[model samples]
Target chain A: MYVDVILNQPASRDYRVYIDQLETLHFDTKVLIVTNTTVASLHLETLQKKIEAKELYSVILPDGEQYKNMQSLNLILNACFEHRLDRKSLLIAFGGGVIGDMTGFAASIYQRGIDFIQIPTTLLSQVDASVGGKTGINNSYGKNLIGSFWQPRAVYCESVFLKTLPKREFSAGVAEMIKMAVTFDKAFFEWLETHDLEDEAHLKEAIAKSIAIKARVVALDETEQGIRAVLNYGHTFAHVIENQTHYTTFLHGEAVAIGMVMANILAQKLTFLNADEALRIVTLLEHYDLPTHYRIENVEAFYDAFFLDKKSEHAVIKFILAQGIGGYEISRNIPKEVVLEALKEANA
Target chain B: MYVDVILNQPASRDYRVYIDQLETLHFDTKVLIVTNTTVASLHLETLQKKIEAKELYSVILPDGEQYKNMQSLNLILNACFEHRLDRKSLLIAFGGGVIGDMTGFAASIYQRGIDFIQIPTTLLSQVDASVGGKTGINNSYGKNLIGSFWQPRAVYCESVFLKTLPKREFSAGVAEMIKMAVTFDKAFFEWLETHDLEDEAHLKEAIAKSIAIKARVVALDETEQGIRAVLNYGHTFAHVIENQTHYTTFLHGEAVAIGMVMANILAQKLTFLNADEALRIVTLLEHYDLPTHYRIENVEAFYDAFFLDKKSEHAVIKFILAQGIGGYEISRNIPKEVVLEALKEANA
Candidate 1:
């Protein structure tokens, strides 16, 4: 039987994460589980127990963003073909956002189209990547510049896996949560200000809220035609940081945390957000031990990379700026000088 | 500006191929022409003159079905990334079916995705692969078991390319047209029996009709959910032949020609198609000098290969059978003994 988990915007439901029981889904087809070392070591057993298929296998890829390249993607696809998984087979993306993107991409290409499910373990993934069907791998040029807006059949966000997540990794997930609250829901942001997310109940509620907001945004604009770019509130500068460091130094959400501060500074200068309000947001980020700034080795190179972003067009950078906390606007053709000034102020 | 070509089903309008001036469509972004050695040598200069882009370059991959594997697919994708071709950069698939599939797949996965257009040169591709958005490369396990249903931004079908195609290759293309007619349009099948494809105008009309039918079928069921399976009328058996022959012995259309005969025999035995009608289809195939049978090394092994097909459900084999000349049905769980009998008869 098929189950539809639709709840407002970012719906949250308690999902079971087990292994070797995939047969219970009543699908008599091949099941390909795409994952990396980190999740494979931590939760592969449980996932395997939940997937008891007639022909079940795992594509264990290299861990980390560095390995999230075309070479690794090809390796995963090769594994899919080697296993003879047909179009009816289900591909389970059993890892973080990287694994989800790569496996989703594999499923998207395998026989031109096939079914895939998202089993997001990381908090960041559970709240964001697992919901929308945007799948892709990174390139030397940029992240997610070459990808598809392919959605998954289902998503299983098992909070059970997050228990093993390191404090820093868990906080990285919170950075994205904060992004959702700040841009989409002022009420949610106010709740976060008073609530202690370290508490289990509060954290779960926060995840549900974040996912609900993201889901609503995605459902309304699956292809990022309009409101979806608001979802990239901090991604503009974050992508530059990730690119500058070659995706090695900072976690994605950590970089995004710094990016949010940069965006806030820009918003303040544009009179979109008050300086005191922006400072409060930064102070809250520090409360979670998130970074608020990053050093750029080459400003010109960093600035140039924005044009190469998937969201950019004809040298026009699509920047999602806040009109104020809990409100955002997607602006195109923001002058290079304006961006440069923001960059300077962010560094200052 | 973007152009969308919709080939109208069953009409000659879709068949009459036209070569529009490529220079007229201008893009500031880089334009990448992906092709093989054979096609490049013959038409690269002509194609280059047509493409007036700010930045233009070509990546000539090794030609032939043998090279249509993951290694080559990655080579094409890596080349695009290495060149720093971002999302705006357009990939032009400038060759036959292999080039189209591999190039489209490469573009689909680069950074998540980039736009691609098809310029099919082979008769087989013009009537078949070029119309559908299915793009992928072969793998160690099977042919086209890995790929995505990525539609091209536009498709340019210049019938002028057919003048250079080998006679055997031209016959190979006829195989798919026959499959389309016999399974979906009986009138078209009768027309093929009485007409010779040597007539360029008539051949173009048949191609256009077949492609229009394919495009409509694919558009309705882009993900192969239902009626789309009809497109695989001969592919079920053709895949086994290609796998057994290591994809070196026969052009894809040639193998498909032999496959249609097998499907016809099966349809006759099941009383879905009359024996006399099957003979008429075989007679038309003979006129084109296409293969109607094959020498099987091992029937069991050949049957085993069907399970490896992308259409199969787990280990279950699926067959597209005709109910009379133009009627079709998708059936699975057919007795293995019956399939083996068909394979033996195909060899006989």
Candidate 2:
């Protein structure tokens, strides 16, 4: 199954996202595969055998979110230079979100942009990160603080690679999948409550459904000027949580899982979501063993961090809140006291 | 006078290039003016007084082509983060091509891209670099080896800034203007041969004419897929010249002047340009005291450096040669021995 991401603004920027499809990929130009040491150890040979290029090279970075910094970005670029990969060269992001984000960014700025494709190994990246064109790296200030809206030529997601994923990482992927359902698709939310993603067929369906919803949102706002901001349903809070934890404690999706719960408390306070609906979202996250709470060490510091998020314009923090199931509201005028109260509650 | 660059493919990318028109400008968001030590000392206050913003800051880098690297790019990004400049905040490229390229590149990646305006201080920048959306920095591999095609919100070119420009630098800017005329506008080339740009009125006309030609060619091919390559007529040889001399022996425009002479020699060999026409170009470059010749130490090493250029694809070097005044040709299949002979002749 595949979903076509149609960006009408620049018709040429449109591409397709294929699910469970990994076949012989042929390229007439030099190709560079950017992966992490972890993914390289497990699946590099598997991916290498499937690609045919005039020249092939691999840049294996250290695994983990902490490694997604300017250093890793440079590593990918240096490899491109070392191999003399020109404007027509191709880069394959052959790992999870970290590898994909850094690789896409490297491609975006390498010779003022080049072609790249995504072969997402983890479930989190396959369903969410790999689909959107938001490519960037983390810095001392925040996550994805520096990047470009560079879309990939194509994306290939195969379940076979997930067989080697750790259980915690697999659960982290489910968090992003649930984020999609709770914010945009109530039917999918209910389906997740009943279906066991442990089953291969159900997992594939969820991936396709989540990607379809994401594709629709990205198509509407390629630059996140409007409807696309809603895709950050849990990410606003998640960024602070990830920062406080130094990106080592939680997987990106795990932070989002906790963040969603925190956002629900704020949504309830804003009267956008009810108690029962909020509880339902929390219960579904628990079903996948995803973290649903984070203790905020300092509420004031956390609140101040929100202002630094790229979403905040001037001093206004635009919060993407769930307006019950399958709907959302972007509130830029949320009072500080109201947000502080929710943060206090989440701290428990 | 102003030339509106209409990029119909993505209407939002369209902007205007204003010549001799730096008036009071206003912005509601935080603004950062990126310049260099020399520009800041000469005209920073002049530019700062003409802009009003909610908050204003400046990042002054060292002035030189050697400083146009990743380190300078990082300094700009660091400042944006330090100032907590959000997505809506604006950046102003307030110096020559080095500052403009680094600033535009910094803005392109800061928060996944932001709006930037060019206020070029140098003649080389005002007439050429500042008008185009090409933003990047140089690396060990080559010049502008990393960057993005990020257009500025607008461009403001003021002749007042040129009051401080050294005579040699002014001649360098004329090299680019001559290049524009030789490739796209024969009438403009003939007029330039007769007009003395030392006169203010003549200089303004030439700036507007060069920008108009550039804006038209850019509108046709924004990404350099076709006719846009013609703009790099002298760059194929210039990049190697700069690289060979470690970017210290000559200014970029000065190198381009010499490169144009070298390209003309090759063009004459290919019969794309007559000997008389080639001599006319060399005379015009010399008219402004621009360097019209360079000693080639090793033809083989210089020839090998062309492959490192981003313009070359898959070991094929695409040479942008002058067909005659006002016409150009992109030749990819020129037997290299013919090029070697031209290099040997230009060696004199």
Top DockQ hit: 2
Please give the CA lDDT of all the candidate structures: 0.79, 0.91
Residue-by-residue lDDT tens digits, candidate 1, A101-185: 8888777776777778888878899888887678887765556655676778777767688889999889899999999988988
Per-residue alpha-carbon lDDT of candidate 2 for residues B33-124, written as tens digits (9 for 90 to 100): 99999989988888889999999999999988889998989899999988889888999999999899999999999999999999898888
Q: In model 2 chain A, which range of ten residues has the least summed lDDT?
A: A307-316
Error of 2 at B280 (Å): 2.4
Please provide, for model 2 over A1-348, each residue's C-alpha lDDT reduced to its tens digit, 9 standing for 90 to 100: 999999866677899999987789999999999999999999999889999999999999999878989999999999999998988899999999989999999999999999999999999999999987999998877778999999999999899999999999999999989998988999999999999999999999999999999999988888887998888889889989887887789988999999899999999998999999999999989988998988888999999988766557757788899999998999888889999999998887
lDDT of 1 by residue, B1-348 (tens): 122345322232132233432445566888899999999999988888888787898999998888988788878877786766766789999999999999988877775677888889988887888876778777656567777866677777777778898899889888889988988898998888887889977887787777766776775666577888898888888888887787788888888888888888777767888988888888999998888888888999888877656556646666899878888978788888888887787778
Q: Proportion of native contacts in model 2? A: 0.89
Model 1 lDDT at residue A282? 90
TM agreement with the true structure for every prediction: 0.88, 0.96
Q: Is the docking of candidate 2 incorrect, acceptable, medium or high quality?
A: medium
